[model samples]
Target: MKLELLASFFLLTTCFTAFSQEKQDTAVADKGLIKVSVMYPYAEGKTFNMEYYVTKHMPMVAAFLGANLVKYTIEKGLASGIPNQPLPFMAIGTFYVKSLSDYQAAIAPHGDAIRADFQNYTNIIPIILVSEVVN
Candidate 1:
């Protein structure tokens, strides 16, 4: 009976932890007015240099993107819902901006340089998305 109670307690704690983490993740997503996401899709067997991305690539983005870059989030996808399944994306990067015009203006001058840096990190082309934060 004691062992069963302990197991039940552990399960409840785990569930609560997962729930709170998911809530926190969603809250982060809701931040800022405009968001620009660059998602690198996962392949069956491929390589991505995460070290270079975080260290070199992101710093370059911040320097070139300028002060208009309100904030940014970089995510390294681990796994899918199902156990042992691969994640749909290798990495997902979001840049928070105040407006579309601001983002366009800031990125315009640096677009070529930003594109050029991709090879230093990963060979895969990322899919980009620009969206308004609703909520």
Candidate 2:
């Protein structure tokens, strides 16, 4: 049941992101900007320490990425589209970079350290997506 819910959430999120960007300018899409999205699916009894995520984890990651990262956004899920439905995801963290290679290289050295810090923030495993920003 948990796996099914997670799969459904991912499918919906991917469709939404793709469709939303469909009408965007192709010229803008020419920029080789890469977006790295980390999403945490919501589940009963899951725990997420938002305070630690925002104040500590994110900042540490940003520092590690340094100049490779152009910008980033953090979102906390509230309610789903259907009334009284559970939020599909607990939170999302997205970071943009001019070059995927640069971002990869930047994070490579600190990858282990980064993963190790997850325990302080949330118990749920994150879903990571790497894609070219089509506007």
Candidate 3:
């Protein structure tokens, strides 16, 4: 009878431990990574200074973001998939961050400066997308 009680207690402790671990894992997964994409739609007669964007503007933004920024990518929009078609976007910039709230807090103070810097790079107003990177 004592041996059976000991085994049952062990099983109950193991189940509780597994349940606790599963809950912790779920909490962490809920706070997944985030991606911020800034895309410039292609437009006739619009101007984009790729040099200023890459060399000056992006670096400045990255500085503002500081440690919250996991990494970033810049893509020059090439020809569309269909032949003889104009590109959908002039350029695309993406930033991967661990936490959306952290990214937001990092950039909140520099919002105005960031927006004001746009004229130095592109005439087209950029479209911004914030999404969770679920993979």
> What are the models' TM-scores?
0.73, 0.75, 0.74
Q: In candidate 3, what residue range of length 10 has the lowest lDDT sum?
A: 24-33
lDDT, residue 96, candidate 1 = 80
Q: Which 10-residue window of candidate 2 scores lowest in summed lDDT? A: 23-32
Q: Write the per-residue lDDT of candidate 1 for residues 1-89, one digit (tens) a residue.
A: 99999999999999999999999897676665788899999996666899999888887787756777778889999888788877889
* Model 1 residue 133 CA deviation in Å: 0.9
Q: What lDDT score goes with residue 123 in model 2?
A: 93
- The lDDT, on a scale of 0 to 1, for candidate 2 is 0.89
**lDDT of each residue in 42-117, candidate 2, tens digit only:** 9999999988999999989989888878888899999898998899999999998888888899999999999999
Compared with the true structure, all predictions reach lDDT values of: 0.85, 0.89, 0.89
The candidate scoring highest on TM-score is 2
TM-score of 3: 0.74
Cα RMSD for candidate 1? 4.9
TM-score, prediction 2: 0.75
Better of 1 and 3 by TM-score: 3
- Could you tell me which 10 consecutive residues in candidate 1 have the lowest summed lDDT? 61-70
Stretches of candidate 2 exceeding 4 Å from the true structure: 1-31
